[model samples]
Target: MPIRTEAWPQGTPCWIDCQVDDPAKAGEFYAELFGWEIQDGGPESGGYLMAAKSGAAAAGIGPKPEPMAGSPSVWTTYFAVDDADASAEAVARAGGRLVVPAFDVMEFGRMFVAADPTGAVFAVWQARGHNGAAWYSEHGGYVWNELHTHDFDAAKKFYRDIFGYTYTDFDLGDEKYVTFTPPARTESVGGISDDSAARGEPAAYWLTWFQFDDVDAGAKRATELGGTVLQPPTDSPVGRSTLITAPQGEVFGIIDPSKRVGEMPAPTS
Candidate 1:
C-alpha cells in the first residue's frame, strides 16, 4: 500500500533544521561532506542558510536560540503536517509537551517545536506554500529519523496517540527496536530504543541518519570535512553504521546500509 496520506497531514519527511553556535562553519562542514549547497537567507533572518543538494533544498542552518543553554548540538528532523496548531495540540494531548509553541515564519510556513514525553525534541511543519525542506535523500540528504528513549512503551504510545502511527517490531529477542510507520506502509518513519551510555542509561532523544553511497568513504569524508566521528562504522543487524558530529558540533548518523531508508526488507522471524 502507498503511504497513508491522511495520517501524515502533509507529505512524509518534509524538512530538518539544526541550531548551532557557528552557521558558517557548519555550512562549510555539511557542504563538503554531503555535497550540499549552502545559501544564506540573510542576517535579518538570523543568517539562516538552506542546505541543498543537486539544486533541490534539503535542510537549514541557523544560530542557536540566544538564551538556550545546556543542550548539546544536534540535527532536528521535522515532519510535515497539514495543521501545525492541531499537531501541537495533539502533542500536548498525548502527554508530550510543546517546548516551543506554534508560530509563523513570515510567509514560509507555520511551525511549533516540541518534545516527546521522553524529552526527544522535534518539530512539526504545516506548509502554506513554503514547506521546510524542499528535497531529501537525493544526494546527501536526511533519509531516516530514530529516537533513543528510556521508556519504549510510553514513547511508542505517545507518538501513536499524537500521530496515529503503527509499527514493525525488530525482535532482537530479549530487547527490540520498534520502528514506526505512518499507517499503511511497512517502512519506518522513525524508531524507538533504550540503550546504555556513559551516564548510565541515556536520556530520550531523536537521532537522524543521512544517506551516503559508501559508508567507509562517508566516514573518511566526514573526518576530512572537519566533522568528528562518535562511533566508527560498525555492522548492525540492519547495516553498517557510525555516529558523527559536524564542525559546529551538531550530532547525526551515517550509514551506507544494504537497504534504502524507506525500503528495508521485512524483519525475519
Candidate 2:
C-alpha cells in the first residue's frame, strides 16, 4: 500500500474522523477492533486520539465540536481543497448550508463543515502541517466514502460546482448510483447514491466504509466489541458489506471489496 506522505489532491477524500461523546471509549473500541495504536493528542489538541496503523495516521477520534456537543456521535469525511475559505464560499453559492465556517486547526489545517443542498453534511480540509490520512484502503483503513442523499441531482450539481467533479452514473437495480471523479483525476474516489425511496425515511447522510479481510468476521468482532450489526453481511457489486454502528451509535460499514459477486453497471454520466 502507498503511504501518503503529503496532502491529497484537491477534492479527494483526504481524511475521516468521528466525533463521539466518550473519546476514551471510542479509542479503546477502535483500537481493539482494528488493532490500531491509539494515542491521545493531549490537551492542546482537545484530547483528540489519533489512531495509527504501523505508526502512520489512519483515522481520528475526538470530542464533538462545541456546536455539536451532546449530539449523537457520527463520522465525517473531509475533502481536500486549496483554500477552505474559498470552498466555503463555493458551498454557499451552490445552495449548501454552512454548519461550521472555515477555521484554522492550529496550523495543521483549516476546515469547515457544511451540508449539501440535499442536506448531507461533509467537510473540506486545507492541509498545512498535517496532511490528512497517511494511507487508506488497506485492511483496517478507510476503503470508500459515499454520500446518500435525497435530492440526487442537486447533490451532484452542488459537489460538482464546488470541486469541479465529473461523474459517471450507474443504474443500481431500481435506484441510481454514480461514481464521482474529482477534477484533474482519472479515477473515481467516492460515490453518491440516493436510495431513500427504497430505504424509507432515513435522513440524508454520508456513509463511510472501512475495509476488512473477512467481512463476516469483522461484523462478528464489532458485536463483541460493544458495537451493533445494523445489517448482516450482504453481497452486491461492491462486495460483501455489513452496515454496522460503533458502540456510540455512529454508523459505518465493514466490507471486503475484493469479493466481487455481480456485474457493475457501465458508466452513464
Candidate 3:
C-alpha cells in the first residue's frame, strides 16, 4: 500500500470527495464496492463520512449542501496548496472563475472551489490539522484524474498559469493526449485531453479513476447495485478499465492495473 503520511506537494491532487443526495445510500454502495469502512464525522463535521480502506482515509462522502440543491451528485477533486486565498486569486487572474471563496473548515484546513477556463470544477486545499487522503494508487483507492475538454489550448494555459504545470503530449494515432506535470516531478500528476468533441456534447469535466483488484467484477457489482456501466471493461496500455455511474448518478472510473504496481512516467523536457 502507498501510504501518505505528510501533505502532498502544492499543485498535486491530494483529496477527493463526492456530494450526494443520500449519504447513507451512497455510503453503502461504495462500502460494498470498495470494502471501505465508512465512519461518521459527527455533528461538528456536518455529517461528512470518511471512507477508510484498511483503517486509512481513502475518500469522503457528504450530503449535498442546500445551496447546491437539485444538482446531480458528483465528485470534486482537490489539489494541495500552501495558501487557499492566494490560490483563489491566481485562479481568477488565470481566467478561471471561483465558485466558492476560501473559508476555514473548523481549523482542519482552508479551501475554495474554482472552475478552469473550460469550466471543469476543482478545489484547492491548504491543510492544517487534516492533510488529505492517507493512501492512493492501490486497490480501492484513487489512482488517476483527467480532464476532458474541447478547448485544449485554453485549458492548458489556465492550469499552467495557476499550478506551474508543464505539458508533455503523447501521440495516440488520431488523437493527441497531454499530461500535466507538477514542478520538479518526473511523472505526470494528471492529464488533459480534447476528446470531449467525440462525446457529441462538447462538455468539459474532470474524471477520477479508482484502482480495483478486478475491474470486470467491480463493474458487474456496480450494475448489480443499481449503478450504470457507461463503458464496459476494456483493455488499455495502463490497465483494464470501465466507466461507471453510481446509483445517484455520480460518474467515476475504475481500473485494474496490468503491472503489479503503477509507475510515474519519466520527466520530459
Q: Which candidate gets the maximum lDDT versus the true structure?
A: 2
State the C-alpha lDDT per candidate.
0.74, 0.89, 0.88
Question: Which lDDT value does model 2 have at 43?
Answer: 85
Residue-by-residue lDDT tens digits, candidate 1, 1-269: 11121223442556778888788888888888888899997766767888877666778988776534556676877877778898888888898888778988877788888888888888888877565555655447776788787778888898888777876777555565777777545566667765533256348777888877788888899898888888887776556778897877778887765733443446652
Local accuracy of candidate 2 as per-residue lDDT tens digits, 1-269: 86889889999999999999998999999888888899888789987889999888899998898988877899999999999999999999999999999989997999999988787889999999999999589888998999987788888899999999999888767788998998768999999987668556456788899988899999999999999999999998879999999999899998998997888778776
Model 1, runs deviating above 4 Å: 1-11, 67-70, 184-186, 196-201, 259-269
Against the true structure, candidate 1 reaches a TM-score of: 0.86
Taking all chains together, each candidate's TM-score versus the true structure is 0.86, 0.97, 0.94
Per-residue lDDT tens digits for candidate 3, residues 46-165, read 889999998988999998876567978988899999999999999989999988788999978999988898988888989998899997899889999998888888989998998899
- List residue ranges in candidate 3 displaced over 4 A: 259-269
Model 1 residue pairs with clashes: none
Cand. 2 TM to true fold:
0.97
Error of 1 at 152 (Å): 0.5
- Top candidate by TM-score: 2
- Residue ranges of candidate 2 with Cα displaced over 4 Å: none
Candidates 1 and 2, the one with greater lDDT: 2
Model 1 residue-pair collision total: 0
What residue pairs clash in candidate 3, if any at all?
none
